[model samples]
Target chain A: MKAMQGYCGFLGLLVSALLVGFLAVLFTLVWVVHYREGLGWDGGSQEFNWHPVLTVTGFVFIQGLAIIVYRLPWTWKCSKLLMKFIHAGLNTIALILAIISLVAVFDFHNTKNIPNMYSLHSWIGLIAVIFYTSQLLLGFLTFLLPCTPPALRAFIMPIHVYSGLLIFGTVIAAVLTGVTEKLIFTLKNPAYSTLPPEGIFVNTLGILILVFGAVVFWIVTRPQWKRPTEPNAKLLQPNGSTPEGTDYSITGDFGNVDKSDEDGEAAARKRNLKLDEVGQRSTM
Target chain B: MKAMQGYCGFLGLLVSALLVGFLAVLFTLVWVVHYREGLGWDGGSQEFNWHPVLTVTGFVFIQGLAIIVYRLPWTWKCSKLLMKFIHAGLNTIALILAIISLVAVFDFHNTKNIPNMYSLHSWIGLIAVIFYTSQLLLGFLTFLLPCTPPALRAFIMPIHVYSGLLIFGTVIAAVLTGVTEKLIFTLKNPAYSTLPPEGIFVNTLGILILVFGAVVFWIVTRPQWKRPTEPNAKLLQPNGSTPEGTDYSITGDFGNVDKSDEDGEAAARKRNLKLDEVGQRSTM
Candidate 1:
């Protein structure tokens, strides 16, 4: 299983690296080759250029890498707390970029005197971004914040997991449609049907996006590929004595921590405590 | 847990129903309202009409529901053989539709003397359809057939699971991009940016596709949502005693079924044998 896991993790990393690299190239092509519009908040098309670059870099690429954090074997050696920070941090960045990208589109529309949320891409993208932002905020309050009550964490954890993954998928869909929307609006000579170089490049980018999303989801959701737990004599303690919390909500424990078994409950408590301890230490 | 499962299953069905309904409406608008081209194999745009309808009906919606078979609680009470058959049957229908859709597109392109596989939508859609077809065939040969050795079944099971889900996601992405491309290519006066009624309709459909994909993936991937095993005394037998082979690969049971314990190994053997027996009986 270890060997298999290592192989799986390696493949995941390879694909993810390709995904990120391809996205970077795509961004370069969009910014450098096709548009040459420098990034800013109010430069019209230049500002709109930031939308795809930042969204791809932050939303698509970074968010994907974040989802597969648990599948990266190298990260398994680190404390679960550190992993959470990475996950939450990546998501936060993605959310910020997505917000900025939205702003860019709106700014472009406003300056151009175009109506907003006209296309399906905009509608879906807006929904995905809003949901992602809300999910991140909820995750921060429930899992990252030291003051979040345990009961509240337990109650909200399931919805958080469901919403997080769903938004990830939704955003990928949005990105695909967004690319299509952009290409159709921009392409004239050697129409999309003509398969011009730019058309081919953009299409390849969309394919890569789909592949990235699929591989990331596969790595993240497959339980068999989950990181192996480190040896902890008190890992399954049914008491609340651990220094740090080892949150199992992501693992879908959903408050059903074997409460009937004192030992199991203690273990759950310890996990969450250790997670919190590690998180606080990192923050400090 | 049962109550929770019931609630979840109900929600899943509702979302799925909405997905199917929305897809139907979207297809009607494309074929009947917007184009009025009707379906055929050689009438140019008329022939192309089948692409969206078949792809959405078979590739997107049916494939999604198939992936969530294990999550449907009603299937939990039935023999695993019946479940597998239903799963395979749905996939078969989806594959057929996808194939027909592809044929329609190529036929339309050929009859109209237009170049094919030029757009990003076409490229990604082609890849997704091919991968999906191959996945279905491999899954059928490996799991549904008796000649496949247990070891091989176990080995291929994970990849099959991963590919099935990934392809499902890819198709959804393809559907989205396809919608965007089609709307942009077709709409003229009151352009897509103008958010004409047809544009709004198509975009709404894309949004629904995203939601459907997200909900289905969530239901299929969540371990807790897995249906409970039925109360057959022979169900857990670790030896080759039962009539049918109840392969549990999608349930993520990698081959290490208590190999350290002879009794456990025997029990697993019995489970598979029973599953095979039940499968054979159903075939008869």
Candidate 2:
């Protein structure tokens, strides 16, 4: 197994994304329970249509798969020629379906008779931000899709990785803001029978912790491409050629090795070996 | 003198993103004005602070540039490559600084000796939906960042384009829902000071038109690419040497006969010939 290198930062973001998802589920349950007995505020809806909410949110959970796929390195080693393409195809389909379904519900719900201040709209708003954060993560994974040029993948990954963290951090800050939102609007007090304590310490702690974690993750998991001139000995190529170039910190390696259309079986085999190395450890 | 084609859709999206941004500015102004006195239903904060809200939002806007940079296509023929990189780089640096500033102010406001419910948190929470949305548009735009492999670009463009409309639609819906958030907690007052009657119709109509336009455009613009064979000319390798035969529609042909990586006589001569072929037109 190859050595597992850097990014102590992903720990924070992974934890935070999971934390937010857990909280969403918790709040979702709370709202559902209260809505059924006509005790909670889902606007004037007789019962919480948890079906739609859950469906959209289930898709959200699927969306987070991008984290697993992307945040970690491409450490899988498979022997099949088309396996990566097949796997990527499946993932692309999954993302497309999930996004389509979730967004459709979002569209319908937004235009429904529900009130905005303290109704399902607010809940959905919070959920949508989380979902969008996860979707960005999902799309970031596209850079790693099968058959893509290594140079192109290398080019997009860092931008995708760091900006993704930024999006996640922004979403968390926004979500915490939402939690406090339910408090500030207490003046109106439309949803809650009584106001929940807007625990300044608790909320601030959430935001800071979330922010700190996100920032560290941003700095840590930031994908550092093997410098361009460095022979890109480990870089990926579309034609499946994996040439072993020396680590050149100089000219000719602009990180864009567009040699996919070229035929080089020897290079392809070398790349295959590298894949096996990464895949072995990742499964471990 | 280039033919007007696939870009119309892009232009439509450009208009939509701007509309959404304009709406955000308008809504921010409205909310500030509406709540300037502080909603009296809850115990109002004795002191006032607007600096934090402004700063967070400003930083968010600064970070928003990444979206613009990532969106528009940047083939070899595109203008001002250096300027594009500069805009992306400088704004990112600025955004980082602003985020730091925002966090400091957020810390201060959250800890202020005032009612937490009526403080800066609520303002952010209420507007978080808009800001998060703006980010989503930006994030989606990044997904469309200039990449080679016309095939991949075509595949990503549709997803990027359609999903963008869907997310934007959802965010707008959430806004409408927020405008009516107060209706959830109470069954009594059908309307409040913030809930202006005109807003309901205007927003709903705007959303409908936007959605209708997006759906129709998708149905009409989608090319039949799933066919098993090249129903047209066989796919040509970029170098015109190896042919990975596939039939694909060319919705985005930028006439790259002489386009290259460097400023040179060959590229200039081609441009001049094209210019002479068709004299300058008023439209870009």
Candidate 3:
């Protein structure tokens, strides 16, 4: 299962980057045409107004998500397996969501925001900024805190994982609208533009991004968030004696003494006063 | 100090929102004026192209920030103080920076792509986006992991935090140009438009948004991502303890055990066995 080193988690990011580049060209061309053709000059097409807002905003947010999911910090005990796989998966999801959201944002330009044209995707893009932002906020805390406290651990940890699923799921919002718009556009007039994806292909990207992002967000944010940092050994005694006034060091490694050394019981008994006290107290 | 919440954030938000609104209206108005005046209908205004792009894009991003920052789901542990304060601060900044960057993106209506009036604000606005995106990335990671591992904690974490500060500081990128342009326009033409802040102030908002976005990303992402789940606990356990194999549940109530229920002997045996099995084996 782990054989796919890089492939496992990069699904979201690859798609988003490609979408951003493609959309930049598509949007730019469309706008340039409007400007040249004087489509909205007389306010005849109010829908065009929504395009610039959607496309540029979507692009910026995509950039925002890219950084968060791709480059989270590391943990002490994590092997290369969980760490790399999680990061890759997260990056893939975020990137995909970003692309779908971007496409959804531009739904206005393609007339998808209208009453009849409005689909689930229109609402998704409208609300996508939240998912993207939520993902970023959660990522930051995990990377910066000292340790995930139990109280907090109970609440926050589960959320990022679950939210990841939702975020990726929401990517469908973009795909639906994207495909619908493109398909309809091509059908409306077979005189499709010079654009490679034409109308239908570009429209379909929203759902692809949604699925990609949700999967990625789940894969990365889910496992790493729930993982622990290091051995949290509770020293049963002060200086290994009693919890009386001894400050509990969450770092469980106690002074190089191998915990498994039980064979030297007789000799070690003299030095094991703390353990004995804890043992005796337990027996009472 | 917390008393400053007396609609302090509100004032900034309202003002920023209004400014954004005015700019949008002004952008479209300017285009209409040019069309009616018949100046840009044919040629003379190469720089005008960027104006609509900038004005529209700026609104999109600032509005995007507004929508996401408010609606996104936060980890259960996010501090109310930090979240509210940062939320208001960054959104305000986004609005201001949008206006500021507008100066560069919309330097002049009848000018060329390489406008003759290129100034410090324009440069700052361009660079500000870099910082804003970086902040978003770092923030996401911090929150996703809350308390990142020791490996790159010092480096990556600091970069994330600093990116936010840079974003805040870069507000001059957007506003300064507007200030100077208006000042010049007013001095020579008395009909000086309501220029945005100049120099540092212009880009200050962008810088702020970048910073705010970064920090917020951290705040929201951490706890949720880092929360401990039962599955994660199982994965971390070396012996691969299933539900039936180990009595140690991964519930957050680690210290809430009922003092061994007054049973000492049996507890000791189990604990001793647990101690013996350190990392290689499980008491189960």
Q: Pick the candidate with the highest TM-score.
A: 1
Each prediction's TM-score versus the true structure: 0.79, 0.40, 0.28
lDDT against true structure, model 1: 0.65
Instruction: Please give the range of 10 consecutive residues that has the lowest summed lDDT in model 1 chain B.
Output: B253-262
Per model, the share of native interface contacts recovered reads 0.41, 0.01, 0.00
TM-score of chain A of 1: 0.76
Winner by lDDT: 1
Q: Sort by DockQ, best first: what order? A: 1, 2, 3
Per-residue C-alpha lDDT of model 2 across residues A150-264, encoded as one tens digit per residue: 4554334333433433333333333343443333343343323233333333344333433333333332322121211223333453322232111111111111112231122
Please give, for residues A1-284, the per-residue lDDT of candidate 3 as tens digits. 22122222333454554465355435534542543232242322443433433333343334324423322222223452355345544554544545553443355334543332233234434455566566656654553343644335323433454354334333332333333333333333433222234433432233233323333332333211222222232244222221211111111111111112111221232223333344456668
Mark the regions of model 3 whose C-alpha exceeds 4 Å error after superposition: A1-119, A127-150, A182-187, A191-197, A200-284, B1-284
DockQ of 2: 0.04
Between candidates 2 and 3, the DockQ winner: 2
B97-204, model 1: which lDDT tens digit per residue? 889888888887788888898877788888987888788788888778988875576556657776887788778878877887777778777677788878777777
Q: Tell me the deviation in Å of residue A20 in model 2.
A: 6.6
Error of 1 at B266 (Å): 21
